[model samples]
Target: MTHITVDLPETVFSALRKTPDEFAQEMRVAAAIKWYELGQISQSKAAEIAGLSRAEFINALFRYQVSPCQYTEAELARELSDAD
Candidate 1:
């Protein structure tokens, strides 16, 4: 695993009510979620990046108000119609 350091304003921690470690974990999860939402990474890869299981990542997606499935409205509609 690679280690990276990020410096942030002290106010950021206080504003989010998160300790540095907590903030780091949240950052990982957030990045993974955004990448997954963007279709830049698979769910398994995103979960690995977030240090979470696939199920946990799905839960995080819901928590962040992001869809777990990477499908557009048009694609979903076409899929539904095809199922008929």
Candidate 2:
């Protein structure tokens, strides 16, 4: 894997340093979940951003109570009609 370096404020780095890698991983997962919740990104893209497999990301969604599937009102109505 390739490594990339990013510069953050010293205080930010210091705060991040307090947590172990596992904590960082969980934070990434949570951020991905929030992004999905906000309709800011697709589930596949969120999984990639979180450095997790699609299955793992779906699991995180379950853990965070974020639905993997989202639909507009029109789409929901269409689905309901199709069910009849």
Evaluated with TM-score, which candidate comes out highest?
1
Q: Give the alpha carbon lDDT tens digit for every residue of 41-81 in model 2.
A: 99999998789999999998999887888787899999999
lDDT of 1 by residue, 1-84 (tens): 799989899999999999989999999999999999999999999999999999999999999999998999999999999999
Off by over 4 Å in 1: 77-84
Backbone atom clashes (below 3 Å) for every candidate? 0, 0
Q: Over the full model, what C-alpha lDDT does candidate 1 score relative to the true structure?
A: 0.96
Q: Residue 1 of model 2: what lDDT?
A: 58
Q: Please, what is the whole-model Cα lDDT of each candidate in the order they appear?
A: 0.96, 0.82
CA lDDT of 79 in candidate 2? 100
Worst 10-residue lDDT window, candidate 2: 1-10
**What TM-score would each prediction reach against the true structure?**
0.88, 0.67
